[model samples]
Target: MSKREMKIKPVIDRTFTDCMEQLQEGYVCAVAATAGCTVEALRRDLFGGDLLITRDGKTAHDQEVSLLLQLKNTTTVRPDPDKETFSYQLKKREYFDRLAAPRKHPKLLLVVMTTSPNQTEWTKGTHDSLEVQYCCYWRSLEGEQAADGVQKPTVRIPTRNVFDAVALTDILDRLDRGEELT
Candidate 1:
């Protein structure tokens, strides 16, 4: 990447904003930890998606394959150990269907973020403080069926769906193979 092309702060900062409540650090951490992965995230109010991540081997400047990310951050404000699965919220069926709508973008990246119930907090005690207990993960929305209602239906994300850098790469690989996210 060239010095002129070193403008990655906006993308990361936007991720931070989208992730502030859910307290998901993966939007910045995992993507940063991974190799060859770059994001072009925006702050759109409506219609357009949040983050645009390039497939592996492509930089933020490259256009080999772009995944439109619809990021959702969930939190367990009231922890429930009896809860079998986390009820993560995606957008309304109509809204999601639109992002999933056919257009110039090839793939829509559905990222489901979640964190421990009320455990993480943004540190304001000092000028430069940070939260330390937030956790998040992702899964593909490729094969899931949409809801028949107008409300933002809750999607159950099993603990098994927790995504690591390898998991993220696999999703990109599936896109490369013309396979929908499984």
Candidate 2:
């Protein structure tokens, strides 16, 4: 048996790890703003992880549904590599496997986000103030399993599977009939 530190050297890269939760929350908020959904950020330790989607404000008066959110962003400080490429180490695959199981009504939805691949910036207001183009993709990991015995798995999220408002709408609609997420 090896010590934890010896087995894994945790690297905290400010470029990516800094304000990470904010990036995910911001993206979800931006998306929900247009889609008429309400998002609630969950506690860090709570398994299944982050964000709960509710019905439109105008529709059910802010009633929540069965949808759990797990966000992954590709926004990093690396200068040359493609911004669309993002790698994440899933610490506890067992927990993920259980969270993504179909037996749960509120399935875990993994959202992968990235800035523009070209690294192009668009004007916000002043010419000096610019922001990178943002995009996101989502997939339901229901019934996904860990490796035969691997504890931590590094997964790569690609750009081609980018999802938009349409996909979000579909997921939200599906949750309407189920139990609300608490």
Candidate 3:
């Protein structure tokens, strides 16, 4: 492959990587909320049907693909202020890299959702290694919940950017369309 062709592969891989990280974080949230539920159980709770189904359609439960999409929206960028470490928060880039490795298939969709007002630099270091499609951040009326039900946490959520054009999307599209982007 030419230099341009060589460059394009990494870009596509990185975009897919970002998407996968989002999916993994989503998976973590789904797992945490369910309190150690199995992946299938989590799937049932979130998607209502098996993981194979993608589009929003009839399923065993009223769960919509949109609900599965909520994973992208459920991340908390910071830890509860009272909590010592940001344990529950996902490591965005690392998660993306693991999922986007060569042998893996793009089986799931992912995105970031935040409850903070500013997200200008959230995914800063991972662009070269991951495919972060959509990044969405919103304000929280109440922030950081404690272990008890008393405290509400502030956070941000970024949904999958499958809807539009982004650097990552541009790269993936080019690759998919049999073109090269250096």
TM-score of 2: 0.62
Q: In model 1, how many backbone clashes occur?
A: 1
All candidates: TM-score: 0.61, 0.62, 0.23
lDDT of 2: 0.57
lDDT of candidate 1 over 1-182, digit per residue (tens): 75523522332444544546434434444553574567665667354456667764455664465566666665433224466556665556765665445554457655665543223243223567444444455545544666576477566655555555776677667766666664
C-alpha lDDT of residue 107 in model 3: 30
Which candidate comes out best when scored by lDDT?
Answer: 2
Candidates 1 and 3, the one with greater lDDT: 1
Question: Alpha-carbon error at 144 in model 3, in Å?
Answer: 30
TM-score comparison, 2 vs 3, better candidate: 2
State model 3's lDDT: 0.32
lDDT of 2 by residue, 39-120 (tens): 7778673666678776544455665654677776654322224566456556667655755567555667777665432222
RMSD of candidate 3 to the truth, in angstroms, is: 19.6
* Runs of candidate 3 exceeding 4 Å displacement: 1-71, 78-88, 91-101, 104-109, 116-134, 137-164, 177-182
Sorting all predicted structures by TM-score, with the top scorer first, yields 2, 1, 3
* Cα lDDT, all candidates: 0.54, 0.57, 0.32
What candidate 2 gets wrong by more than 4 Å, as runs, is 1-16, 56-64, 75-89, 115-132, 154-161, 177-182
The sequence of per-residue lDDT tens digits that candidate 3 reaches over residues 1-182 is 66633433332443544554444454444433333222322434332112231222244763322112223343335334354323223344333332222322223323334332223323334646544333332111112233333232222322222222243334334434544222
